[model samples]
Target: MTDLHKHDRVNPLRLPVVAVQGLWLRSTLRLASAPGGGTSGTAPGPTGPPLRLAVLGDSTAAGCGVTGDDEAFAAGFAQEVATRTRRPVDWQVVGQFGATARRVRFRLVPRLDDDLDTVVLLAGANDVLAGRGPSLWREDLTGILADLSHITHQVVVAGIPPFGLFPSIPATLGRYLGERADALNAVSREVCGRNPRTTTFIGSPAGTPPAGFFSTDRFHPSAQGYRFWANDVAARLLPAQPDA
Candidate 1:
């Protein structure tokens, strides 16, 4: 059968599967409760000039699955930065759940202050789900970076996590979404490469995430997962510094 015919023939069967997965996700989320809101703080370190860092993006950047801001990636990364520099880290999060790059550009970007030393952006999952093409993603993401560049000396754009590995999503849909994420990541990398002030951060490797990496909802990262992700980003952002 032609690929088009095959796709049409199999779609009816896939629709029910997709619906079941969607229902399961909704029920699980209701029971798990939403993660606490964004976190901000100054990490402990030897008294010195502090590194002011601002984190921006979607739910992941907001620390969705964690119980509090301390357990979120923003705080975790701040801790890592403090340890490495032996200097205090002043961190703030301006992340919103379910926000696309466009939303972040128009709504969140304006809230950023002018004294930030660095900015970390972890986004693109929502854009993938929203069916935004690579070109559009590149445009929105580059715009966000351009705006951020004016506020901070350094900007780190993180690669989207491997959502296809999420336990809750159906295999077929996960595969499709994975491809979309890959496209966006490529754009992210290119955008970062072209900008001297911006850098790229790669998250966990592809394939299934280890047990306990995700929260009960099987989507957002758990506390442990955020810690792990923060460490990875820290390594790239401060490669010269030793672990603390």
Candidate 2:
């Protein structure tokens, strides 16, 4: 059996725990209000046409855990790029809560503006939660990269967050899901490697996040969490400049 299948095979003893955690997660989601209003904005920079950037994926892409889009990953990354590159960034977010890689490919990718300078894709967590195997994750991710290739040469794909460390998840269930996420990220790295213009933004090294890293629900990143996450991703996404 493949490694993915091995990971997919959960201990029957843990099934009840997994089910309970799933229910708790659902309840938390129900209580959280989806962030509303415009999903597009600009980060000011030096004179010139702004750099067009589109952030597409699931709830994290939608900035659900934060009170405002400005505090989300997209905006933070945009500002970082603008500050570093000295170019105005026109950022747009095309995302939905609970979206999987396949969902983003079909439903969100088409919504991206054709003129974008870069497309940042943040997905795959839902695929893990949905119990999708690596083969399917690869197919969906491959399709996403293929589609985005037609739109822009620069596509930044963020690696799946570490599920094992989520404070809200029970240890056993979290470990199971975290392994699945790692498997998906391996597939992601492979897929992005094949695409010359694609770069996988693997966030900070795995460790237990500090208090407040997660929002109240404890499932998604809080604003402070996003800032650190964004900084890491932005550093990777932007090209290195020579020292003066």
Candidate 3:
């Protein structure tokens, strides 16, 4: 982390700007939460050996703003992989709203087992929201990845999205938060890149999100948005398939 005085001196308007942003965020955005945790399901498809997959992280991993567990990122990704490979997919989600990297590492990882073939981690947004520094973010994420490696050789870590691109947040605040998110993502990529045996960074789609991609709350992704996320992850995992 950079020197605090340096950052403060550089961005003199940051405090007031952040204050305005906080007020705007509180007033405009809906308080959305991820629904139905410890979620599990099977994706129906042609007969074949089943692939056990697990998704763990924060709200996005929990499928907040989506109606059912089937519509969540984990389920959507599992279903697509199952359909494409003509294999049965047994998938589960263990996630919660407002979960940070440290929280997920300490709270959720212990509950998982080593039976999973793959694990997808969707996190860091909450860390950015809480103003966590890049170093702390890297430490917690590294620990999480290490714990996950014991359970599965394959782990996909989703890069943090552009928080400033969300429509609900004020532009100034969005820019500030976006910079922080970018810093966190850089840490994630560096950590994953160094651990080829266990971790791979699958980035979120870049650029400003299109209209209707966000849910009614304008914070979490809509179902259509989740589909896009699932598709991206599925594509990465598909290359590992025997058929590919």
Model 3, global lDDT: 0.80
**Where does model 3 exceed 4 Å of error?**
1-10, 34-38, 240-244
Better of 2 and 3 by lDDT: 3
Best by lDDT: 3
Model 2 spans with C-alpha error above 4 angstroms: 1-7, 10-16, 20-33, 36-38, 201-205, 239-244
Candidate 3 C-alpha lDDT tens digits along 1-244: 1121223334766868776667667666675784733388888878778988898999888888788667778888998889778889898888889989999999988877677888999998888877677889989988998888788868998888887788888887777777777888888889999977777887778666666788888888888888887887788757645653
Clashing pairs in 3: none
lDDT of all predictions, in order shown?
Answer: 0.76, 0.78, 0.80
- Decoy 3 TM-score against native: 0.89
Query: Between prediction 1 and prediction 2, which has the larger lDDT?
Result: 2
Candidate 2 residue 125 Cα shift, in angstroms, is 1.1
The regions of model 1 sitting more than 4 angstroms off are 1-37, 203-208, 240-244
lDDT per residue (tens digit) for residues 1-244 in model 1: 0111122233466655545565555455432335463567889888689999998988888888878758889889999989888889999988888889999998998988887988999888888776677888988987898788778888888888776788766676566566667878888877888865455656555455667988777778888888888888887778556544
lDDT of 2 by residue, 1-244 (tens): 0122244565667766777777766555432338532399999987678899998998888888888758888898898888778879999999898898889989899998896788888888888877777998989888888888888868888889888888777677677788788888888888778755455546554566767788887778888887778888887767755544
Q: What are the models' TM-scores?
A: 0.85, 0.88, 0.89
